[model samples]
Target: MNSARESLEAGYARARQDAARSLETKAGAVGAIATEGAGRDIGSTLLTMDSRLASLRRHSHDYADDLFRWHTVLQWLGWLALALIALKSFLYVLALELFHSDERMTLGFDDAQPIEGSYRTGAQLAIDRHFPHPLITRKQLSNADNHLVLAPWPGSSPLVRIIRRRYFFFARGSLLEDGGRVATVADTARGMVASAGGGQSIVEWTLREGEQVIFRYKDFFGASDNVSLRSELSLRLSTLLFGRVIFHSARCDSGEGRLLLKASVEAVDQAQLRAIPLERMIAWSRHAQFTVHSGRTPWKTLVNGFTLVRRDRGDGQHGLILVSSEDTGANTGSLRYLKRIFSSIF
Candidate 1:
């Protein structure tokens, strides 16, 4: 009886052990399923975060492109504004020229009426007009019927005075009488002339009749220390009263004297004399100085020394004179004729 009871108890114990084993295996399978589900959830969350980050990067790139375009547009607009400003300034200058007119008429040379005395006086007048400080006094040496000689006064410099011993030869040629108008040509010659001393220069005029041409020879001599600095400047000032036009051409050295070569063509309508303002005429005259010095070296340096003024004339004609180096003491000439022709138009 005892043995059968023990075998039955043992079988019961074995059954309990087997049941425990089966339960452990089923628990393990369930645990594995739960782990897999958790892994899937985590993977799905990571994928969602990655997609959001990519969208943000795309948005940032789009914003950067937009900012770049905006910057480019602003830069272009800025350049356009500058160009417009320059254009307006140019138009203003053109407007001034179209309206203003005041004319000064210089009497042409006449042959018949006592031109001998006139020529002598005119020569003196030209010298006085050109040289504010005369280094020598001029004396009339000969006043014959057809020929005249002007004696040179003692110059300030002994060397120049000694050189001025030569006589100034003058001769009157045939005159052209065009109806009421008369133009006379005079020939002048001077030999053995020396430096004026200091920075002074002499411009001798030779007028020929048939060609209706005037030749001006400018002689300059440097200081004793700068004898090597010798130069001859020349220019032709031609005017045709019938055409109401004047032309000027000059050749000068490389230094401060370069202003001698500046020349330009300018015209104003004769009919619009009353409408142009004095200031406008003055500005035009001043601006025209640049036309002469547009190219070339050294003389261009004097561009800063220009001055413009409208002469107060009681007559109906308005006159403009652009003076370069207004302080006569400076080393420059009075560009009066230049301003006058440019201020008037036919």
Candidate 2:
């Protein structure tokens, strides 16, 4: 815009100079004619030329004013756009860094009603029930809990809602980042599983004699799904993945610097889900499991969801595969849908 204005102004100055020089030459001619006593007849013509030159100058000035106004407006709009982009970026970063919250598993014994049986011993019985073979010593884990404490995961809040709605890519990138490191396609699959698996408690367990508390999957989250979890690691998921799998029930035992985790994957069919009181769609999604048809249409197979697992124990999805998405139930456009899309693809 500035360049165009300068070019126009320069052209106008050159034209004005040329017109002035021509007028001076004409004036000399008129003087000569007057000296010959023949200029009186053309004096009105010179007046008309002068009026036309003034009009041209006025129009050139007006043109420059209009061009300058346009340039200013364009510059303002450009700055406004840049400012909006920067604001969005700042909000996104703030949401990720400032808003992440964490809660861990602990013996909330201070509830202070009245103590009955030993909660730690009760925790032991619960673990034994979940794992008939007992992978850990009775001394390792005695804490009663489950459904990996949603630590470092944003809870229900206004900022979280805004991020999900307006700044979703930031959240998505963070979720994928949860999937640890990746070097090969196999490593990528493992990282993706870890991402989908979601957050856990600070009390990481090792099957050996460790001072951490044990919260079996049953005590916490297994009751919601009503499916019996197997004890051995990766005991249930040894086949192909043709649906978005939710590692809803995982029994992880930390052993010898390695984690042995077991879980079952289920894809929910909301349509066939039976409504339960206020739960409605949520109840259906929770109670039911659906199968995806991975037939001739690879596109549908992908859209529906699936995982590509290698035929090795240590190759895919770490020791277990599960991805969790917030099931904020609704008619459509839930976080669950986004989780399904991402978990299926990666």
Candidate 3:
């Protein structure tokens, strides 16, 4: 009986040992499953990160491309601007060349009666014709404005001249004319007068029984002495003729002397100087009697003169006449004609 009991106990012990090994194996399997799930989660996270990084790289590349395109466009725009500036400069030079190449002169005339001869006396007519009305009353002329002089010149004659005797000082002169030449001269006792532009000498001439004349002489100090003289003469002639009509007529400047002649013949509500179409006036002048004269002199070397005349028809419009001259240098006849025409008009 004892032997049978021992065998059964041994068998039961073996069975218990087998059951413990099976539980251990099952625990190991469960731990392996948990580790595998954790690894899978980590792989998924890494994949997602890689995808995001790729997307970021793509966006960065697109941004770089856009920036490069903008830079290129800016460079092209800069080149275009430079080209436009160059073209404008070229056009301006061409225009200046064309303007200097043309030789033309302009004259102004009044349709009223001739100023040379009339039924008027000498000094009385001069006063009535030349001098503008005094701006101030006799009382104002006596006031203490040293800048303003009561009388431009202390003379009984109608004509007066304003002179600049210093770098920027002003004086006066008076003259009388006999026939077509200036006879008498009087000047204020002052030092060398200067002005904003330059030094100036002025003379006033009273015709025997006609209009008074104002002659202004400007002397510039520089390399352009000759050019200045020519410009001044041109300006004087222009002033004599058209100064009473046009508000701002054309001017001539030759690197030295600058002359400005401004007139407004609109005294009677623009009666004398009406605004006619430029094209119509040009056409009329073309059809009118035209005469051209060309000559050469020792000084000028080359010269050209043009004269145009149109008689008064039955129409109410007044007749038109124009005379112009262009000389290279020192032929004074054209200058004389300019003076004559101016005298006739004024």
Every model's TM-score:
0.25, 0.21, 0.25
lDDT of 3: 0.30
Task: Write one digit per residue (lDDT tens) for candidate 3, span 1-346.
Answer: 8889999999999999999999999999999999999999999999999999999999999999999999999989989866844453344233323322332432332322232211111111111212221211111211112233344323312121223221222222112223465434332221121122122221111122222112222111111011111111222332222222112111113212112111111112212432331111211111122112224333442233222223333344332311111122334433433333323222
Error of 2 at 218 (Å): 46
lDDT against true structure, model 1: 0.30
Backbone clash count for every predicted candidate, in the order shown: 5, 5, 7
Error of 3 at 193 (Å): 48
Q: Tell me the tens digit of each residue's lDDT in model 2 across 220-286.
A: 2211111122221111221112212222222223322112222222333323322121111111111
lDDT of 1 at 214: 16
Give the backbone clash total of model 2: 5
Q: What tens digits encode model 1's per-residue C-alpha lDDT throughout 133-240?
A: 112213221221122324322132324323433223322211212446443443223211222323333223111111111111112211111011111221212112
Model 1 clash tally, residue pairs:
5
